[model samples]
Target: MSVRLRQATLGDLPLICRLRVQRTAWLAARGSDQWTVAGKGRPIEIFAGEVGRALDAGETWVAEVDGEPAGTITVNRRSDPGLWSPWELAESVVVHFMIVDLRFAGREVGRHLLDHADRLAERADRAWVRLDAWTTNSDLHDYYRRAGFQLARIAGPGAHGPSRALFQRRVVPAHPARTAPSRYSLQGYSGGNSAM
Candidate 1:
């Protein structure tokens, strides 16, 4: 149980790309049309660029299991301005590029990663943690539902295809996880690293 989060760096560029593109095949096999585009399972260079930007902004993170990188997420103060209205962006820190290793599928690694995002949102004083899920991926939507997220209204496509299934959940304590002494710490994070 050596799960923890650490800030991603330039050195982690390949790891970031790998995380986003790896489980995509699993997603496609489940009859989901999400991220099955391009040979790399996604728009790799563009995604890598986004990860680089988040790395510069200190918003990207890696979740490690027993010292191996198993997942990653990008939690930031806003969503694509064109996709979300002013209000939603104002009240939330948008979550993006969340992926757990396919190998850790049944290990609750995704849940832990999201709980960590909630903690980050709470620390940043955001009232909500929000995300735009893949529109056609019913299973992913159900997964978010099981994670306690409520479906906000779906937005029509602006530029980025139709992965606009908006979802949101409140920022609250991560019960029973002993996050108070947070087993993980995100370096360079401005918020108190108190782990709760």
Candidate 2:
């Protein structure tokens, strides 16, 4: 199946929130508390607010598979305050709110989204793509490892959130000969708007 990505608009808020809730349920079923709050999923209002900010900043993208919304991701230069040293934030494109609909699982939608992040980093002249995963989600950590990320470090006690498992992968330019034409395309992406 082919995946396409487009900049997310405010109108897409409900779709993104639904994907988040779906993912939360999926994780909970697996006995993981990644996106939950006291055994229940995160409240839609709080999550929607976060996604709304990203949408307004033009940092969020929706991934569509077979012309249907399958996932969403937000990448930008701003790291959550105190999660990364200033130097690290300056040199990296931070990823957030990456969620894939369970129906699209195993279809490499997540990998394609990361590739999109890599391309965005390359275009912005950043050195790496960095993200903070759920601190207790070992499966998520392994998934990131298989996707080329290396564990940087867990945040110290001073960090405020539960998503403190830091991971980063260097931005390696894709060799032309081996690089396949992307099945996905970025819509409304402007270097000036997205650059750090």
Candidate 3:
């Protein structure tokens, strides 16, 4: 299957939220508390608020497979407070809120979304793509590792959230001869030729 990514809009809020709920339930079924609160899934309002900010900042993207929403990812320069040092944040793009639809599981949609993040980092002149995975999810950690991300560190006690398993992958040029600027044709936005 081919995966196409486009900038996420406010109209996609429901789809993103539904993806979160669906993934949460899937995780619960596997006995993982990654996105759960007291054995219950996180409130949709809180998740929506977090994603809303990313959407507003134009840092979120939705991946589609065969014209159907299959996954979502958010990549930005901002790191969650205390997750990374200022120097680390300055040189990297932070990935957040990545969720792949259960129906598309094992289809490599997550890999394509992450490849997009790597491209975004290269376009933005960043050195690395960094992310903090759910601390308790060893499977997720292994997933990132298999995706070429190295485990940086587990956040210390000072870190404030369950997403403390830090990981990063260095950005490398896919084609060294291609020096042209990257273009993104985002719907509901301008500057289609600019870097995303």
Candidate 4:
């Protein structure tokens, strides 16, 4: 099956909530009890709160595979209060939260969502795309690395009850439309820069 990414709408809130619940359960199963720390209540309530706000503000995306909601993401332009890095938060776009059903874990849906979000960020003239994952989940940290994000730094054990490490990938400025090619365009330059 193939997964596709699309802008999220208000109607998607319900499915997004369900996905968050599954994600919380899955995370807890892996010994990351952070989700349960907030109480045994449904984690979707909190996820829905964030997703709803993002959707209303027009900053959400969803990934679907064969007509099923496989994953969801909320990309915001604002930094969480007191949680912003002086360097990374200067950008216009940030990934606040993202999750995929365990059933769709290895299908590359998350990478597709990231690619879509990157395009959206570039279109908005954003300088970077950033996110935070639990520091204890090395496996998830490696997953983000594989998705082309470089580690930024660790933030405190916030209300989420887990130490989180921020990650970021810088977005280069997009070239403007031109009828004639510029002289500096495609000149002799090696691709060995560390920027990649």
Candidate 5:
């Protein structure tokens, strides 16, 4: 309810840094396979570097709900190299570090972020959107399947030791309006908007 996605820029670095800590802590609590670093840790510098690169590439996004930052996603052209495979590498839009604040987990925040990435990927002329998840989290894997991603492969057991599974969804091209619609008309809500 009342959620929107904004393009991420250099100004968001601080917020992204904070959210990385929150997300990493939550993942550690779950003892989920998502944590691949030795000692169950991820350096903020690493997150910062990744976010900085994505922003520089014009691929990061932030989701705000009720005027507050509620989620984050890194949508980039970078390929994830460690994922196992039924997933074939294609020229695809890659989505990484998808996180919705745990306070809003049961809500559709994560879905909205992902759907936005899907639309963005399509607009970039990508054939598919790809992502990876920890191999041990059946619940999360199932959640993605329901959201339309097909399991591609289970790669990983990376240096950090947690295996990861790859997933992908083909993007359907959207039909653009030949002429602009009325300024005040509320067009159809795309998947990037709240489900509610």
Candidate 6:
């Protein structure tokens, strides 16, 4: 079983874009250039243009928890033309515009989303699940590294590029998979350790 990844519809635009806005604000508060208005993120016009194209290509999917939108991801078969070499584009599925709602920050929703992406890659016979992360965000880099990706290279010398740090991991969602515990099992204990 995998997290439900549904094809996004026109009606889902508000939820999707809202999550992006939330993530943009979250990153800014952390002093990260991951997605700010100063060109780390695309201009609104370009962002909407990419969304339209991805929707047309049927590459956008939303992970909904309990019938409510929780996050969005775009797994494109082609890499961004300016960021990756043509050879890299052919071998892997490129993950773009991933945004998880701030409320789901520590719930492993993003991991589950990536698991869904892994299944997509597996079915497509792709060798890897790849993404371009923001270059200066070492914290974000470490996050992906913990999720099993390896750094390939820092792709650009300047700040004005579309996610310059490339990372990849083989589509190996380890079986018995790293999953959240049954919520029922934690009923007796608060998140904090009382004994401590």
Q: Best lDDT goes to which candidate?
A: 3
Alpha-carbon local distance difference test for all models: 0.71, 0.79, 0.80, 0.64, 0.66, 0.68
lDDT of 4 at 21: 64
Alpha carbon lDDT of residue 48, candidate 2? 94
RMSD of each: 5.3, 5.0, 4.8, 8.6, 6.7, 11.1
Using lDDT as the measure, what is the rank order of every candidate, best first?
A: 3, 2, 1, 6, 5, 4
Model 4 RMSD vs true structure: 8.6
Where model 3 places Cα greater than 4 Å from the true spot, the runs are 39-42, 184-196
Error of 6 at 134 (Å): 0.9
Task: Quote each prediction's TM-score.
Answer: 0.83, 0.87, 0.90, 0.77, 0.77, 0.81
Ranking by TM-score: 3, 2, 1, 6, 4, 5
Candidate 6 lDDT over residue span 85-133, tens digit each: 7777666677878788887677677887787667666555566888888
- How does candidate 4 fare on TM-score? 0.77
Which sections of candidate 4 miss by over 4 Å? 38-43, 156-163, 172-196
Deviation from native of the Cα of residue 105 in model 3, angstroms? 0.5
Model 1 ranges with Cα > 4 A deviation: 38-42, 157-159, 174-196
lDDT by residue for model 3 (87-170), tens: 997787788889999899999999988988888877777789899888778888889999999999988988766788899999
Tens-digit per-residue lDDT, 1-196, candidate 1: 7788888778887987776667666665666556656322347677778778888877778889999998888888656545677787666777888888777776877888788888876665567888888776677888898998998877775724556778889988655353354433333434520000
Instruction: Give lDDT for model 3.
Output: 0.80
lDDT by residue for model 5 over 96-177, one digit each (tens)? Answer: 7777776777789887888887677655555787877666677778888988999887764552324356778887655553
- Residue pairs clashing in model 3 are none
Candidate 1 vs candidate 2: the lDDT winner is: 2
